[model samples]
Target chain A: MLQTDQLKFAYTGGDTFSFPDISCERGAHWLLLGQSGSGKTTFLHLLGGLLSPKSGAIRLEGTDMAQLSGPALDRFRGRHIGIIFQKAHFVNALTVGENLALAQELAGVPVDNGRIAKLLDRLNVGQKIHRKPDRLSVGEQQRVAIARALVNSPELILADEPTSALDDENCEQVLHLLTEQAASVKATLLIVTHDGRLKDKIPNQIRLDS
Target chain B: MNILQLSWKNLINKPLSMLLSTILFALGVGLVSLIMLLNKQLDQQFARNLEGIDMVIGAKGSPLQLVLSSIYHLDAPTGNINIGEAKAFLRPEHPLINRAIPLSLGDSYRGYRIVGTNHNIIDHYGAEISEGKIWEAPLEVTIGSRVAEREGLKIGDTFYSTHGLDINEDLEHDDAGAFRVVGILQPGGTVIDQLILTAAESIWEVHDHAPAPVGAAPAEEEHDHEAGEEHAEGEEHTEATHAAPATDIPLHERVDKDITAILVNFKARNAMTLNLPRTINENTNLMAANPSYEISKLFDQLGLGEQVLRWLAYIIIGVSFLSIFISLFNSLKDRKYELAIMRTLGASPGKLFLLIIFEGLLLAVLGYILGILLSHVGIEMIGQFVKKADRYGFTGKTFLPGEGWLFLGALFVGLLAAVIPAWQARQTDIHDTLAEG
Candidate 1:
């Protein structure tokens, strides 16, 4: 469902990164492993369409991401791709339900409260739907973030070190939930992290050299 | 869910800041609107009563006082003018005068002036009698509609007059005989609506008990005969004799046998009209004043107070704008991470910009509504105070001029205050911001 070829990126007056090419078939789960300063986060951003690649092309469901710019790229990213960042962040002023509804609205799609409630229920966070994101515990907040990423049912899901802040048991449980949710939606999953614990669980892996 | 809803949530999140900005904005707008209401009403009141009469001739004092007293009935008279000396303009055959109405002052009932004038003054105000006949005899008076309504006086009711403009029972002229209410006039919406009308003979008879001047004949029989003839001639002929009969009181007697002032209307605008006031001031013992000119001077004197107040209001508005800018700028700093998250959720930079601007506009709209309500309440309070203190009835429901423009001005201020902050929000780097968090 996703493919990239020699993707490269650089910040202003900063270090440049040339990423190894990778390809994932539909419904495949993979791990991207790298040490510190190895452009793991940079490669995730380029694949998510949050940043334009300096050179090369990222193909998602056959459309080249480099050709999209402005609002068109933004809409494409919102509808076809979802990213779970390392930290759980939300609009603090809104309740969990409103935050989820805001995601649908910003993606320019009709909001389905039933779908949101069902998704949260599957993640075991249905009872906290009315509570603000800050009022929830760390585990509950992580589950809500996962639900937010999966709400659009995008084709490709990218996670950036979502388990780094949790204990081993909670980290294993979170990874199991992520893969199970990805499998249920039939979406390809790619997790970028420095944690070695995830290497044995998902054998399909790509490593970035520093 | 919507942009407006999101903006509302953002504003409510910081209640103290929004409240402070709204209060300051309301105060500034309220003061300006109050001044506009007062200025417009004052102009309307002055302009409505200042019509028809061309010049006021009275004792030599402040020309403004003469206009205020004889035209608006709002102040004490300068002094009295001799009817004999004022007779030239009072005559029907005068070359440049069309109508001259005489006023006899120095008495009031319950703070309303008892203007001792003929029915020509009634014609001058265009008042139609709603109840009874006009006064035909000495001590018979016609009450204006407002005076009758306020004092509960009807035809056939009798009341005693006091010696001056204020209502003090110790200065009551009860011994001068009670004046009967012979008529009640319809409301003219002019200065005449606050007056009690009587023949000038009533004033003479009231003060006739004062010691006579030296070498003056008693003329008691002539006085009685003239009063009876005045009753028979009705009020029409009384108009022509308002000044002439002063000389008829025997010229060798005291010149103090006088009326308060003469209000003159010109037959045509001419060189004589230009020179009339100079002629009166130079040759006669009376001072002539143009009501419009004196009123313009009054506005000029009042303009200083208006300017100072206007500057204060503008400064307050400026401060409100600054406060709004500061509050928004600080809140934008706090929400920078949240805005980046929204961008990650697919909100465009333009949408974020509009969200910030919408918050500012919401505050301004709320402040403007509060300010308008406050000004109306203030106007009602002032109307009550003026009615109680001066017996001048004022309506507080008048819609002020320039308020529509004021609305636009307030919206412009909101837009101006939000521009920089909104631009800052639009330029937020989503990648850098999310990376930090």
Candidate 2:
């Protein structure tokens, strides 16, 4: 479960944003939509604990994110939250399996190859475990990124415009995979995007103003 | 996976740049190590050859030339000294002198110097006869072990002596006589290993028929038949006393004898140790040159060239460090986004910093190994050249005394070169970097 109350943030020498408070239950999926300059990505970053909210109390499972700082904040985020970037970027030098293992290591969890293999098999990318990310097709790469997000079985999943660059068919497939993977892990999912194509798929939505 | 594995993968991602940096580093280390090996071995060789001789007394010329010729036998003699004048220190009653060995150098057998001296010279070098007896008769020679092996000479093999130090067959003294090999000295790892030893009278006998040079009077002493009897009665009769065949004639009267030099070893801490050199230099026609002083001067003359080469090697090392720094810095800029992605995956700033540092350490260790191998190969090539030039083989396979310091120096360079890049990596703005894409 995730909760926020009166979250407001501002960049240096930039305009401030006052966000609407929201509450989401466990195993629920929601979309955060906004136009360009609407600070949609900034809001996602703030929720992911990558940026501090100027005035906020973000609660994830009854723990306040504002109280955590430095390494404590990083460790808590790693163990409890998973993030998917707009572009599916990977460390080009490591194999898919190694990347998955790295996610677990950074989360301070013992590496479980069995969990990684099972996640990849469920995502229909089990054959790409030993291949470098650069050698895989775009669809495979996206699936591997999704598998990485679920490797640690975090409580919340945050995706930032993950399907904006794909075709309509790939966009639908990626959205389905993201929601399915989040459901399988019993995690609350939030996707922030400017694309209106995702409006009909996810009924629960929060729209930000520029 | 681990930081080391990640660093390794990152390094290999840009194979060309990493390879270039490693090669530059290897060249720098290899040159410095080669110089250290050569300088150490040459210093050891010089010190080893100048072991026993305290002072060299030779004709009035350059003291360095005298030391080089008499002690190392690597240069031409200054000139000849009167045998009668140099004989006073050879007397057993002399107070300051412990031992004095006379050397008459004029001829060579196949580029190896034929040093005409008494048995005392062999004793001073601790050379034992390995095959045959010592030379007792004129024109009978004892070759050194290396000389015997190199020249393929054995006992009773006859060889003609050349007139000068070089191996010129045109200057061969065939008319004088063919010198027979009577003995072979054992290998002493000194200058003695390159010489052919014979009695002092053989030098005088070899040039007995040649006309003496003008303006120099060959000192001819009349034989006091009683002194000859006394010499035979008193102590061991030296080979100088038996130069003449007829008993009625004096030994020096037969030929005006001249010696090239006299190597003297004084009694330890004797009062005359200080006074003898001054007395010999200022009073006598011969000059006394200290082997240690002359060798130090030789090093001083060679120091400038060595210093310049050392600086060049250091500059190469500096350039190598610069290349490593530049390569790492450039790659850091290119991998900024990837690093930001890692941060999102829960990698801390300190871990990213260590990953960059690990890359540097890996490059340095690989370069060090390659550099040491290159230096050893260089040493082997130089050793072969030196062995061909002189029979004295250069021992370059041994590790140098300062190599441990070199290892530390390489590591320090790697650490220093990586500091800025690793700092940049640690300071990466993950939010801004990820937002760009």
| lDDT (Cα atoms) of all candidates against the true structure | 0.83, 0.82
Instruction: Give a tens-digit lDDT track for model 2, residues B170-279.
Output: 76766555788889988888878889998776776656533332322222112123323322333322333444433233223433467788888887756669677879
Cα lDDT of model 2 by residue, A75-150, tens digit: 8787888999987888877889999998888889999999999999999999989998989998898899899988
| lDDT per residue as tens, model 1, B317-388 | 999999999999998888887788778778888988998899888888877878877887888888888766
**Fnat (0 to 1) per candidate:** 0.52, 0.55
DockQ of every candidate structure? 0.64, 0.60
Which stretches in model 1 have alpha-carbon errors above 4 Å? B209-256, B390-396
Q: Residue A63's C-alpha lDDT in candidate 2?
A: 88
Q: lDDT (0-100) at residue B138 of candidate 1?
A: 62
Inter-residue clash pairs, candidate 2: none
Tell me each candidate's TM-score: 0.90, 0.88
